[model samples]
Target: MTPMIEIDEVTKYFGTKLVLDRVSLTVNRHEVVCLIGASGSGKSTLLRCVNRLVAHDYGTIRLDGVPVDDPRFGKTGLQKRAGIVFQSYNLFPHMTVLENITLAPRRVHGVSRAEATARAQEVLARFGMDGFAQAYPEQLSGGQQQRVAIARALMTKPDVLLLDEITAALDPELVGEVLAIIRGLKDAGMTMMIVTHEMGFARDCADRVAFLSDGMILEEGPPDRIFGAPEQPRTRAFLDRIIASGRL
Candidate 1:
């Protein structure tokens, strides 16, 4: 079976400073991969490269074995192949929940308003946010807004979903609800790449876990191996500091 996403010898540089050093990985369909590391580890950069949000300076990225970084990717067709959800819920505050979810589908995909609404309603129901369809972003809580953001991304019916710290800004009490929604997506076989600090959720939801350090992948393995018995000194040290600091 073809992998959903593949990165090979990928390197990204900002000025003379290199951020990603020949990093490579593969994510299969229905699989969840978690990227864990300190800030400036290139985890976010790698995510951006997957969708051409930040074009790489070197190396190749293939989506379902089709080279995506090539200019042909856009000329041929790959723009609607993936979806992204950010740390901050980037919602249109002026639009109602349904409107926000329906905008892209209607405009970009040429999905009729009525058809988009139907899909939005189904997605919102799946996200447990159907009750808020008529509500505005400001009227909803942070967790609720993030769920709306997820639903909006799902509105595109993407093959791969990129989540960057989607739960980071939420109140502690509200984290569980968002994580629960993600768990539901995983249970339903959504292919995902998650950059998160929520260790327990990553361990529970990730098929594989990767430890990124500096600009390189210091360790990677099944969750049991990465979390239970990390092979690298950097991995163990990182985990130690997080645990000792009571941040894990």
Candidate 2:
């Protein structure tokens, strides 16, 4: 079967600095792959490349069987299929939750306002934000805003979701709520690629775990092996640091 996402020998650079170097990975349908590494490890950059939010300097990224950069995808098409949610909730401060969620479907996909709103309402209810449809971003807590952002991404019914340190901005007490939403998504078989610093969450939710260091994928395997018995010394060192910081 064709993989839902395929990154092959991809490389990226920011000016003279290389952010990703010959990285390769794949995520099959209904599978969740967690990317764990320290800051500046290129995990977020790699996720962005998959959706063309950031372009790779070399190699290919494919969605299903088609190259992400193919003209057929256009910018909107690719994004419609591969939705992304960031650490910071990017909702428009002026828009209500319902409006924020339905904006893309109504504007980019050309769905009628009524239909877009109906879909947004359904997604919001699923994410436990049904009562907040009229609430502005500032009116909700950090977790609520992030849930709205995830709901917005799902409004288009994306085939694959990319999450970049989604719980990073939340208060410690609020992190579980956001992570619970992800657990529900995993139970529902949503295909996902997540860049996160939450090692325990990664171990529990990921079908596979990848360890990236200095722009390279040094090790990847089932979460048990990657978290329990990583092969690379670099991978071991990283995990040790996480354990030292009491984060693993």
In model 2, pairs of residues that clash are: none
RMSD (CA, Å), each prediction: 1.5, 0.8
What is the per-residue lDDT of model 2 for residues 117-203, given as tens digits with 9 covering 90 to 100?
A: 899889999998999999999999999999999999998899999999999999999999999999999999899999999999999
Where does candidate 1 have its weakest 10-residue lDDT segment?
Answer: 70-79
Cα TM-score per model? 0.96, 0.98
Distance from true location, Cα of 123 in model 1, Å: 0.3
lDDT of 1 by residue, 120-171 (tens): 9999998888899999999999999999999998887889999999999999
Query: Candidate 2: where are CA atoms >4 Å away?
Result: none
The best candidate by lDDT is: 2
